[model samples]
Target chain A: MVNWQLYLLMFLPLAFVIVFNYVPMYGLLMAFQNFDPILGIWHSQWVGFQNFQQWFHNYQFWPLIKNTIALQLFGLVVGFPVPIILAIMLHEVANDKIRRFMQTVLYAPYFISTVVIVGMLFIFVDPQTGLVNHLIVSLGGKPIFFMASPRWFRPLYVFSGVWQGAGFGTILYLAALTGVSPDLLDAALIDGASRMRRIWHISLPTIRPIVIIMLIWSIGDIMAVGPDKAYLMQTPLNLSASQIIPTYVYETGLLNAQYSFGAVVGLFNSVINSVLLIIVNFIAKRLTETSIF
Target chain B: MEWIRKLPKRSTKGDMVFDIVNLGLLLIVCLIVLYPLYFVLIASFSDPTQVNLGHVWLWTRHFTLEGYKVLFATGSIWRGFVNSLLYCALSVAISVPLTIMAAYPLSRKDFVGRHVITVILTVTLLFSGGLIPTYMLVRSLGMVNTIWALILPGAVGAWNIIVARTFFQTSIPNELLEAAKMDGCSDIRFLIQIVIPLSKPMIAVMTLWVVVGQWNSYFPAMIYLNNTSLYPLQLVLYQILVQNQSSIGITSSPESMAAQQHLAELIQYTAIIVSTIPLLVLYPFLQKYFVKGVTVGSLKG
Candidate 1:
C-alpha cells in the first residue's frame, strides 16, 4: 500500500533480474575482447570486430546460418499449423468427453523433457534395434540409420520437435476457440452453413489476431534454436546438417574455452534475433494491426 | 451411441463425412503421440535381449524385472533422483514467492516506474546476454558447482511475474485495497491475508509450471554443476542416454560383458520411466490447472 513497502517488495526480484539478465549484457562486451577468465572482463584486451570477422570468414558460418534458418522455416511451415489444425479438429468433435480425452492424451507429451524426447528418438531410431528400423526390416525394406545419417538430421529434429510441442501449442488456440462467442456459430448453423464453411468464415476469422501474434512471436525467436536437443542429437556423423549457431557458440565458448569467439558468435546470434523481431513485429503490425509490443 | 442416434434425421451428409474424417484424423494423431510412450512402458518390462534383438512388439516378450533391478542397483540413479527432487522443491519454493513479490507491486496502479520496469523486463525476453556471458557471470559469483548456482540465477522469471501481476490486478480489485487501507491494514498484511487467498489458482498454476520446469531442467545443471553428486535426474539420464557406454561402465569379463549389454538395453527404458513417473503421476491432478494456467493472467490474445 505504502510506497516504501511497495519498493521493498519490488527490490529483490528486480535486483535478481538486473543481475542475472542485464549484467550479462555488460558481459556481451566480452565478444569484442580477447577475454581471459584469469584477466577478468575488465582487464581483458579489446579486439573490436576481429572475432566477428573471423567467424564470418569461418567455413562453418554459411552452413550454420543455412541450417538454423532452414530449421526455423521448416518448423514454421509444419509445426505452426499443427496446433491450429488440432484445435480445429478438436472443436469439430461433437462429443465433449471424446474431445477432452484426446486433448488430455495429446498434452501428455508436452511435459516430457526435451532430453527425454531425444532419448525417445534414440530408442525409436536405433539402426539395429529401434522400432522404426525393426518395422522396416520386417517389411522387406532396408533399415535406415536415421540418427547417424547427416541427411535425416533436420527431419528428425523438426518432426520430433513438432511431436513434443504441437499439443502444448493447441492449448492456447483451443482457449481462443472456446472463448469465441457461440452466438456467431449458432447463427451460421441456423443459416444452413456447413461445418467447414462456418469454421472457415467464423472460427478462423475470430482467431486471426491470435494466429498473427503467435506467428510473429515464433518468427522473432528464429535465431534462438536452443542448441540443447540439437546438441544432444549431434554426433560426428550428423555434424554437417546438425551444426547450428547455438551449438557452435556452446562448443566454441564453453567446450573449447574460446570465450571471445563464443561471445562474438553469441552477440551475432542475438543481434540477428533482435533485428528479426523488430522487422517481423513491424510487418505483423502493418498486416494485422495487432502486435505484442 | 444413443446420443448419435438422437441427432435429427435431417443432419447433412457433409456433416457425416466431416465427423468421420475428423475422428479418423484425431485417432491417427493420438496414435502418433501415444505409441512411443506405450512402447517405452512395454519395453521396460520385456527382456532386454528381446528388445535389443527387435523381437518384442505389440506386447512384452520375455517379461522380466531385470531392467528395474539394474537401475535400482546403480547408486548414481538414486543419488541423481534425490538431487533432482531437492533442486525442484527448493527452486519452486524460492521462485513462486519471488514472482509474487515482483508481480504485486507492478500490479499496483499507483506504483511509479512500473512501465519502465516492465519494458526492461520484457526486453530481457527478446535479447539476453547470450549463454557464455551469463555463464561467466555465474562462475564469477562463485556459484559454479553449488546448489545456489542452480537456484539463484533463475529464481524468478519475468513472464511469470507478468502473469501473476495480471492476476493480482484483475482479481484483487482496487476497491478491496482501498477498503483494507481505510481499516489501516498494512500492505504486507493485506497481501498476506487477502491477496494470497484470492490468488491461489494463479499460484497453483504457476507452481505447476515451475515444478514441471524445474523437474525437467538439466541444462543449468549441465553447465554450472560438475560434481557427480550434484547431478539432477535428467542430467544423469542424459549420461545414460547419450553417452551410455561410459555410464554403464562396461567390464572386460566376456560373459559379464555380454549379460551387461543385454541388461543395459532394458535399463535404458526403465531409466526414462522412473525419472518421468513423478510427473506422470502428478499430471492428472495438475492438468486442470494447466488449462487455467494458459488462459488466466494471459492478456487474452
Candidate 2:
C-alpha cells in the first residue's frame, strides 16, 4: 500500500513551500515586467530585458558590484582561516578546563545580535568620545572618523564579522579534530615527533575535508553577503564602500517603490550566486572528491 | 590498564615550549574577545562625561545609573522586548512541528516521492527568488503588516529540514517502526510516542536554534511591519542604536544638545548590554546544545 500517512504528514510543509518559496520564484518573473503594485504580477506589462538593462547601465552598478565583491572577498580571505587555526590551537590545549573556558569566552560574541555589534562598533570607534580615539589621542595621533572614513569601512565590517563569527566557525573543525585517533597521536609522540609535527601530519589532515567544504560554501556565497550588518554600519560618508547589492535592492524596491528594477538587481545577484555555487562545487569535486552536492 | 591509558605522556622540552606558546596565544585571544564586552558594561555604568573623556576605562568612573534610567523610561524598548518574545515563541511553535513533520517522512526509506521532495527543498538552499520577489509575494498575501509576515514566510528552512531529516534517519531505526506497525500502532501514534519522545534532545536543540534566530532577526520585522507598535527588539535597537534616534522624546535645545549627545553615547552602551544580556545569560547553559546542533547538522546525509 502507498504510504498515504506520510503524504498527510508532508501536507502543511509542502503547502508552505508552494506558497512562500515557489510563489516567490514565480514572482521573479516581475524582473522582466514593469511590475506595478496596482496592476499586480499577472497584469503588469512585460518589458523584456529593459529592467536588467537599466540596472546594467545605472550609475551605481559598477560601484555596487565592486563593493559587494570586495567586502566578501576580504571577509573570506581573512575570516576563513582564523577558525581553523583557533580550533587547532584549542585542540592542542591538553588542559580541558582552560580550553573550555577559552572556547566559551570566544563563542560568546557570536550570540550578540548584528545590531548590537554594529552599535558597539559605532560607540567604540566614535572619534569625539570613543575609547579607540582616546587611545589614538594618547598615542599623539589624530582621531580618525573611522565610521565616516570609506577606507576603514571594509576593515571594520570584515574584522567585526571575524570577531563575532570565528569562534562559532571553529566548532566544526574542533569536532573534526576530536575525531582524530588519540592512539595515533600517542604513537607519533612516542616516535619523538614534535607537537607541531604531529598536528601538521595528524590534526590538520583530519580537518582538511571540512575546511575545503567550508571554503567552497563561502565562495558560493560571495555575492550573497547579508545586508543587515552592512546596512546598520553604513553612513552617508561610507556609502562608497558599503553600498552593496542587497542594500541597493532594499533602498530601491522597498523604500523607493521601484519594484521592477530592484527585482532585476536581486535576480541578477541570485543568478550569479547560483552559477558560482555550481561551478565551485564542480571544481571542488574534481580536485578533492568532496563537494556540497 | 585503565590507569596506564589515562597516564600523561612524556613531555619533552619541545612539547613544553609548544604547550606554553599555545596557552599564551589562547589567553590573548580570550582577552581580545572579552575586553570589548567588558568595556561596554563598565561604560554603561559610568558618567557620560567621564566616559566621553576616556576616564571610564578598566572600571566605572563617576559612576551613575542615568543611562539605565533613560533607557527604562522609554516605552519602546519594553514594547519591542514583548513583541520579540511573542514572535520567537510563535515561530518556534510553528517551525519545530513543521520541521519534524516534514523530516520524519523524508527519513523513511519506503516513503514515496521522498527524493523528489528532497530535491525541491534543497534547491531553495542553492537558489532563492531574492528579496524583492519574496517581499512582493508577502505583500500580495496580505501578510505585510501582520505577525504572520514575521513568523511564517521564513519558518521552515531547507537547512533545518535537512538537519532534522538527518537526525531522524540516523537516530530513529526502521526496526522500531516495523515493531510499532506489527503492534498495529498507527503512524501518527508511533511518531507521537516513539519518534518524538526519543528525539527530545534534537527537538530541544531545534527549538533553541529557532528561538535564537527569531529573536535576533530584525530584517523581516523591519521590512514587513511598518507599525511602530509591532517593532521587535532588534528593529527598535537599530533605530535607537544605529539611526541615533532618541526614542526618549527629549527635545533638544542648544545647551541640552551637548547633554543630549552625552546621554546618547551612554544610552548606546546601555542599550547594547540590555539587548544582548538575555542571550549572554543563557549562552553558557545552552552552549552544549548549540554545539550539538551544529555537529548534528554538519553530519553528511
Candidate 3:
C-alpha cells in the first residue's frame, strides 16, 4: 500500500523546493547579518535587528511604503471593476460570433510582454513623434510629457495594466457567468425582466462569490505590486512616484551592492504581504463565508 | 415547445436600450484595445520623420523597410533573440517534467505524505525568502552570467504544480490507476504509458504557460547575467526601447545627427514588432488552451 514509486517521484521535486524555495529562506538570516560576500552567511557578523532598525529609520522608508500602497490602491480601485463589467457586457452580447471576436481582440494585448507594453507607452506618448501627442495637438492642446512627469506615472501604470489585463481577467468571471442556469434567465425573461435587470438579479448574484474571492486576493496582494513594468516605466523624472519597495530593493540591493540591506527591505515587504493576506483572508471568511484559505 | 422555438425573441424598449448601450460600450472598448496595436504596426512601416510629425496616422506614409532592416542587422538583437529562445526551451524542458513529477504524487490521495508535501509546497505560494536572498543564493551558487542562472532557480513554480495536480486529480481517474495496478503496472510505467498520454491537454496547457512565461521574463536575466551576449530579448529591448539607447550603430556626424535620431526611433518601433510577433502569431492557435489553463487552475482544489 505504501507507494514507494510515488515517494521516488517526489524526491527530485522535494529536493528542488528545499534548495530553491527553502534555502533562500535560510539565506534570510543574512538580513540580520552585516553580510559580507567573502565571509558568507555562516561567517557574517550577526547584527540582530540592526538591518531592520536601519531600514525603519531610513529616509526613503515612508516614501517607498506610500508609493507602493498608492500604486496598488489605484490599480485595485481602477482596475478591479473593469473585468467584472467587461465579463457582464460580454455575457449580454447575444451574438456569439461577435462576442468571440471581441474577446479575441481584447485578449491579444495580454500576450504582449511588459517590456513591449512600456515601450509602446513611451512611443505612443512621446512628445515629438507619438500619436497621442499628435491627437492632443490637433485637438488644440499642449503636448504633455507623460513618461517624464511624476504626476502621470500612477495613472499611466494603472490604466496600461487595465488595458493589458482586463480582457484576460474576465476569463474567470466569464467562466462563472456561464455556470448561471439558462432556466433562471428564461424565467426572468418570461417575467418580462429587462436585460439590465436580469443581469443585476441573476448574473451578478451568480458571480458574486467569484467577485468576492478575486477582491480578497487583490486586497491581499496590495503590498506586492510587481516591480517589472514599474521598473521599466521608471525614468529619472518619475522616480518620486515610481520608487516603490521592490524597485528600491533592486536598486539598493543588487544595483548598489548593499546585499544585506536589500535583503532586509525585501524581507520587510514579504512579511507585510503575508500578514495582509492572512488578515484579508480571515476578514473575508468572517464577512462573506468565502475565503482563499 | 414548438411555439417557444418559433416565437420571436422577446425584447422590451428597456432591453433594447440596454443592448444598444452595452454593444456601443463594448465597441468602444474593442477600438481602444485595438488602436494602439494597429498604430504600432502602421508606424513600424511608415517613414520615421513622418511618424514623428504625426503625418502617418491611420496608415503607413512613405512606407519603408528601413527600421526592420536596421533591426535585423543589429548583432545584439539577434543574439538576444537566440538567447531568449534557448532560455525558453531549457526552462520548458526542466519545468514541465518537474511540474508533472511534483503534481502527480500530490494528486494521489493514497500517496503517503501527500498532505504534508502539499502543505509544504502551498506555503511557498504565500511567502518566500524575497528577492535579495534568492539573488544572493544564485550568486553563491556561481550561476552568475550562465544560462543556468536564468532557467534553474525558477524551474518549478508552486502554482504550476498545484494547477497540474488539480488537472491530474480531476482528469486522470483513480479507477484507471487501480486497473493498471491490477495488471502489475508500476507507478512510473502507468504514469509514462497511461497518465501522461491521457493528459495531453493538461500538458499542453502547462507547456504553453511555461513557454510564454519564460519567453516574456527578463528579470532573471537582468539580475543574474552580467554578460551582454547572454542578455535576453526583453533586456536588450529594455535598453533600446525604454532607455532610448540605440543598439544600431549609426555614426553620429553633426549633419547626419537628425537622420541617425530618426533611424533610432524607427528601430524602437521595429524592435517591438519583431519581439512581439512570435507570441502574437502563436496566440490564436494556443488561446483556447491558455483559457483552459486559467479556468482549470482557478478551480478550488
lDDT of 3 at A68: 96
Quantify all predictions' global Cα lDDT against the true fold. Answer: 0.86, 0.88, 0.88
lDDT per residue as tens, model 2, B1-301: 2311223567677777777778788889889999999999999999888888999889999889999999998799989999999999999999999989999999999888999999899788788888899998888889999999999998888888889888888889899999999999888788899999998888988998888898898989899998999999999999888898866756759888888877777888898899899988887887887788899897463
With a 3 Å backbone cut-off (N, CA, C), the pairs that clash in candidate 2 are none
Which candidate achieves the best DockQ against the true structure?
A: 1
Model 3 chain B, TM? 0.94
DockQ of each candidate's interface versus the true one? 0.70, 0.63, 0.64
List model 2 lDDT by residue over A98-175, tens digit each.
788889999999889998899889888999988899999999999999999999999999999999999989999999
Clashes of 3: 0
Q: Judged by lDDT relative to the true structure, which candidate is superior, 1 or 2?
A: 2
State the TM-score of the second chain for every model: 0.94, 0.94, 0.94
Ranking by DockQ: 1, 3, 2
Give lDDT tens digits, candidate 3, residues A22-96. 999999999999999889999999999999999999999999999999999999999999999999999888777
The CAPRI category of model 3 is medium
Off by over 4 Å in 2: A288-290, B1-9, B252-257
lDDT (tens digit, per residue) of candidate 3 on B121-233? 87787789988889888888988889898888888788888888988888998899999999999999999999999888888888888878888887888888888988999
